[model samples]
Target chain A: MENKTENNKMTDEERLELAAKLDKELDEFINSLPKKKYEDGWPEDRWEEEMEKHPFFMTKTPEPGAELHPLYEGLQKLKYDPEENEPEDLATSYKEDGNFNFKYKNYRLAILSYTEGIKAKCGNPDIEATLYNNRSAAHYFLGDYRSSLKDCEFALKMKPTHEKALSRAAQCCYECKKFDLAVEYCDKVLDIQKTHKSIIDLRRKCIQSLKLKERNDRKKNQEEKKKMSEEETFFEEILRCGVTIEGGLGGLSLEKLEPCFPQLAAHRVHFDENKHLVWPVVFLYPEYKIMDYIQEFNETQTFEEQLLQVFECSPEWDREKKYSPDSLNIYFENPKKKLGTVKLCDTLGMVLALKDYVVKGGTPSFILLVRNSPAENRFLENY
Target chain B: MDWKPRHEERSGTLPQPSQETVKNLKELLKFLQLGARLDLKALALESLLAMTGSEDGIKSVLCVEEILVSLVGLLEDNSEPIAKDSAACLINLSADIHGPTYLLNLSKNYCPPLQSSPDTIVKECLKHIFNKESNIADECCMILSNLSRDEHSVGLMFDLLKETQYGFDDIINIFTKVDYNTRGAKLNYLGPWLSNMTQDQRVREYILDPEKCVIQRLLPYTEYKESIVRRGGIIGTLRNCCFEVLSNQWLLSEEVDILPRLLLPLAGNEEFDDEDNDKLPLELQYLPEDKMREPDPDIRKMLIEAITQLCTEKQNRKYIRDKNAYVILRELHTWEKDAAVLTACENLVDILIRTEDEIGCDNLKEVDIPEDIAEKFQKLDV
Candidate 1:
């Protein structure tokens, strides 16, 4: 009964006190529940939601000890570091693979690696030079000299005085026997390091080899000259000694004479048989034995002379003399005595002898001799 | 060197059967007949070869058309000796006016033997024939020398000298006997052979050989009065050996320098003007309008064929490139109606199709051309 008036209508101070005690009780209760801890120390689905909302937050923020955000590191460091994110990892992997394969003899794989590294780096000249030089060596070993040379050229382009690259390039040029290029590369190498033995020695070898070749070539040419001269002399003797088969006067014209009567022109004599024309007396006496005469004939000398020698020949002499009294001798007016003439038959036997003689370097002068005619008007007359 | 001792002894012991020694009915018939049978082919070949070494053999070989036919056939034959014997015979024949016809026949059919013919003798014979008349035997020797490019054929090329009793100086006779005015038939068939051989591997080998005397023979030819033959021979020889020599570094460094020695003669040849003659000799001068210039159409037609042969030969074409191919092409483009120059123009066009588009007619500045003709040079755009 007393409760009716007790707290129901308590004063405002009593209500306030009660409310404060309730607030304190509520705060204590809220604080008292076991603290909710993330098992992985992150909010539930926090990363996933953050990635979807503003992915830049995770990417742009630097992880502890990551100098710059790993993703945002400049291209140069990304290419060098081994433990970066996907893109950076890819570049590092290529660089590592290139060096590894290059150390091995797997040049093709190394080239692939280096090329990938270059791609990853996007045309850095240092990387390009490495790729080119390594590939050049690979190509050189593969006997692809031209390709090797090309790569060396590229490598040289990047670092002009790269001695190893230059030496290798020169070696490739040498292997391809591109002496000119080899000398050029060697010169470049010498410019970098003036007394490199291998390079100097190679240049020396090239020079010596060139000199030896020149000397040997000169000697060979000399011998060739000697042989050619001998042949010329042999042909000359054939023209000189071979018999001249008389042809019809119409054939005596300059044109016909050149081909048919080569003997009239006195073609040069062969080296072996130039002895006969010491005197015209040799022609009249015919004292030289057939063998001796044959020795002067060079059958292989020319086609016409050989033709004459292979065919048969018969000699006919016509003598006519005209005594003009004013001329020295009026004693005998023999028509035959005036002009001395001899005719050669176109038979096979005589021609062969003449041919054989000419081939063997014999010059039978009677075929070419023309003298002692009163008017010097005698000419070959045969059809 | 001593490989044929037994054959030499046999030859000495036997009464050597003369070409005319056919006393039996069979022998007499073969001798009397112009053609030789299969049985007589050997005898005829022997006679022909014998004639090559001496003047007698030349006459003996010339008398037999049968031998000539056999030789021509042999030039095409798989049998090596067939060509070799024929070439030997041709060398003898070429020295005579009548012999040139036979040489021409052989030149028409000559080609290097197929690999099927293992005998190098045949290849050597082919080389000899080419050496005799490379100037005119362009196709014949080119085909044969191309065949002789193999390692085996190259090894046996010295057979050209089997009958070479004379030395290098003998080469002088090839030009010395005949004046520039001479025509119709060649006095020395070797002119063509030498010209042709210059394009051959065997000839190159001979030129490069330390022991052989072929270079000496070539020396006289270089100074020859007939500039065409001289230049043709020298340039052809250099062109043929270029690949081989250039491939060998040792060789390239040393011997490669001598190309100018040969090229100089060609330069001189281009300088030679036909002095005081309205008509240049077909063999001695380079006349673009020669065929059309002839009074007779038939002769002009023949000249056309000859000029075509002179320019289109593979070696010749290469020389043209080296000497003044582009300039000549330009000149030919502007010049009149010579069948040869026209065909050459077609060839030049084909060549342009393969040449790099960047290399234009401007490269021709190295060669000398008349200013009038120079204006006509084409810049072939490819």
Candidate 2:
């Protein structure tokens, strides 16, 4: 009985050994197939689908002791779970769709999808902000400024600190001509960030426009008042000085004095042909015959004549010189003694002072002395 | 009365102090601040530590910060004897809470220009201050190893590395020294350092030798008692060898096997990307063409996977292309049995098909006599 049992056991062992050897051979044969030979005639898509069905990316084969379900199975469970189908999930799905639509330049679809996301997750700050921010951009693209502003305000309210939301809100306000609100939003952005040049420029433009409006209003009011006042005051000052000053110390009529002053403007002395101001006053006011007066004054009978003579000695008293607003020459003259002592601060100022004293102020014999010009070389040359 | 022995009389002794404790403390402080006057300082410090014990001395030193400051000053002394004495005193006192203060003081005072001190004695003193039973040895080794390789300390450093305890890390750290006194001194001293090293030691030596010295000695040290040491030794050796092999023309062709040993540890960790390492494992596998047909599946699998990974990684594909890896991969594909192996083989086939013939893709089809696999090849829509 023992010998029979031994023989049976030996045969059993041999059969098992044979099976193992064959398994090894089969494995080798399958491996030996050339890489291309197996892939050549096989439907590549079908193989890929089959591989996906079996979870090819998994690190381990399905076994009894494995800790978790296969990745495909887990993903499926997650897909159908009630919790996964909640508002947050809906929001996420809609958001992804919106992003995809946005990428494809489907702004209309993107707006719809983002709106759905906002509706599903009303309490979710990020979703709410993103939805409104995105819809604002869509409405902006569509040229619906009112709707864009509405959506942007919603976004800003949901997340008060949202940068894109605030940016969009500002843009919407700007588009709608709500310049104050636009500037306010921009100021908010600037408060959060001091270096946002675009926001700063926008705010600056808004403020400038408001200021321009105020300035235009002020100008309009002043112009109207001035127009009425001009009409009311016309007859008094206009008729009073129409081509004439009624009173004069020389007993000269305005028409005659106009020509007379031209002669008086030139010729500093009575036929004193060597004097520096003689030709300037003579040629400009040839009829005044101030040369006789100047010659009498040169005789120096009064203190005023002596003072006027001091100005006559200066070369800058040559009245033919042109004066500009910035002329460096200045001449100081004391009119208390009715004497002109011309002192040229510079050539320009000195000439201007002399012209003003005699022509404009009608001051006779004023003392004018050059404040800073060199000593009167013209007198020395004549001497 | 006549019982006085000649030996006892000849061995003279100093009289014991009334305050034995104070006497010991004085001697210990002197020893701690051992100066050029070696015997006095050593005897004094040794006597004090022996009398006081480390706890009392350490406690006293910690309680008295001023004493520690003085000890630091002594350690930093210019005279070798003085510095060495001070280092001993600090080392003894280092057991105290004030010990860290000594290290802090040393770091603060000696870190900069003094770190570059020319005197060998001061450098050694600094090094000794760092060496303690505590893990401060790591830091000490670091400072010493860095200091020793300095231009002024290179001669002294070579003498230091001759000590057996200077391990592989030390050599690597020391090799980073740029301002070593002489290139010849570096090379000349390296040969002797490498001569007596075990196989593992040789592995580390190869890493340090920029100019590959006689490398045969390193082969034995590779046979280490611990697998970690062996593996680590391999990694270190190969990391250094790869630099020598690829860029260094002076490196030997026989040392090509070094690259294979480098890739051995990489098999377990997927994060160990050869792309970052520049196809080192693939280069290693290619080094031995006959190994492809070796019966060991594990060896074959490692080689194929590593090469496939190398081929797949975009950064390393060029090297793979350059080495004509596709042909061997095609050869492996003909015999590969495992499913993952088949995938790798197919990838190798795909890479070869895409690669230009300059990379030796022409030989891709010549190795096979299998029909079904060949037919799969024909069906590929490249």
Scored by lDDT, the top model is 2
Model 2 alpha-carbon miss at residue B379, Å:
99
The list of candidate 2 runs beyond 4 A from truth reads: A1-84, A216-383, B1-382
lDDT per residue for candidate 1 within A1-383, as digits (tens), equals 67887746878898899999999999999899899865764466686754533424553434447455334455535555444545435545676776676676767776677566655554556666776777777777667878888888888899888777899888887777666778778878876776687897787666555444444454455456557676555434434544332331222222222322233235433233434321110122111122112223443343234324432342323123221112211011112323222223222223333422221112233333223333322322220
Q: Score the docking of each candidate (DockQ).
A: 0.01, 0.00
Q: Model 1, which residues run further than 4 Å from truth?
A: A1-96, A112-121, A220-383, B1-382
Task: Return the TM-score for each candidate structure.
Answer: 0.24, 0.22
lDDT of 2 by residue, B26-114 (tens): 44443443232566654554544453356655554444333344454455545555554444555455333333333333333221121
Compared with the true structure, what per-residue lDDT tens digits does model 2 show for residues A196-235?
7788667766755654554445445545555656533432
Q: Cα deviation of B372 in candidate 2 (Å)?
A: 99
